[model samples]
Structure formats: C-alpha cells, structure tokens
Target: MTWYRRYGRWSLLLSWAPFVGDPLTIVAGTLREPLWSFVAIVAVAKVARYLAVAGATLNLI
Candidate 1:
C-alpha cells in the first residue's frame, strides 16, 4: 500500500515538523490533498509548534 493508503489525512499533522516537513508537504501535493485542508492543518500544526517553542524559551529565560 502507498503512504496515503497507510497514513491518510493523519500524516498532514507531521507537515510542520523539522527535517521531515518539506518532504511531507511534497507527499501531500503528490497525493492531491485539498489545498484548503492542507493549509489549515499545516498552519495549525506550525502555530502550535511555534507556541510550544516560545513557551519553552520563556520558561528557560
């Protein structure tokens, strides 16, 4: 089975991760995931990651 067949939409959550993010985005395109959903999911994941990093930094300071 293909990556899409295995992971499906859940894989989009990893699109904001480092190293793997770019490739995951490419996979999403190759799989023809809907633009709106892709943008929305990726945006949310990225924002959450940013917030977590910011929070950790502030706590360390």
Candidate 2:
C-alpha cells in the first residue's frame, strides 16, 4: 500500500521531468516577472513531454 496507489495520476506529473528540468526554476521564474514567458516555456516543455510520452506509449502498444 503505497502513496501512489491512492494517487496514481501523480505519476503523470512526474513524467514532466523529461522536458522541465527543475521545479525550482519554474517556481523562481514565475515569481520573477514576465509571466507570459513562464507560461510559454511551460507550454513548450509540456508539449515536448507529452509527445515523448505519446511516443513511448505508442511503442508499447
């Protein structure tokens, strides 16, 4: 009985790491200024991360 058993979806969030390097970077950058830039970077990182996940999932299928 692990935490993930109750929070399975959390694994998908961890999947973000392949593109988004550090959590501190995201938090620190968002805190700084230029909010749109932070959104853009996060968007790109998420897109890349999804594509990678999709590729792996497809290969598994």
Candidate 3:
C-alpha cells in the first residue's frame, strides 16, 4: 500500500519486471492509476523487451 503511494504512475513501469510485476499490476489497480497510462507504459516496456530478445536471438543464430 505504501509502495503504491510512493510509485504513483511510475508503478506501471514495474509491470515489466519479473515475478513481482504481476502483483505490482494488482497494486496499480488498487491505487487507481490512469488506465491509458498503464496500458501505454506496459505496452512499450513489453515491446522493448521483445525487440531486445529478438535482436539477441538473431545475433546468436
């Protein structure tokens, strides 16, 4: 709960982290974060992660 207050909108970025990312999403909901902000942040983070992984895989191949 305290973490929610501390993070505010920035908490959406936590959604990209490992294991704890899921729970942070739940916390974001409870904190009433802006829907569009959460969507946009998470979308960008996930997309970036995918791109990085793809680049690494291509390099390895």
Q: After superposition, how far is residue 24 of candidate 3 from its true place, in Å?
A: 0.9
| Prediction RMSDs, each to the true structure | 2.1, 10.9, 2.1
Flag clash pairs in model 2.
none
- lDDT of model 3 at position 31: 74
Model 3, range 17-61, lDDT digits (tens) per residue? Answer: 799788888877877788898889888877877787898989952
The stretch of ten residues in a row with the least summed lDDT in candidate 1 is 1-10
Q: Residue-pair clashes per candidate, as listed? A: 0, 0, 0
lDDT per residue, candidate 2, 10-59, as tens digits? Answer: 33344357454465345444446255655565567678778878989899
Candidate 3 lDDT at 53 equals 85
How many clashing residue pairs, candidate 3? 0
* Pick by TM-score: 1 or 2, better one: 1
Cand. 3 Cα-lDDT: 0.79
Best by lDDT: 1
User: What ordering of candidates by lDDT runs from best to worst?
Assistant: 1, 3, 2
Off by over 4 Å in 2: 1-15, 18-22
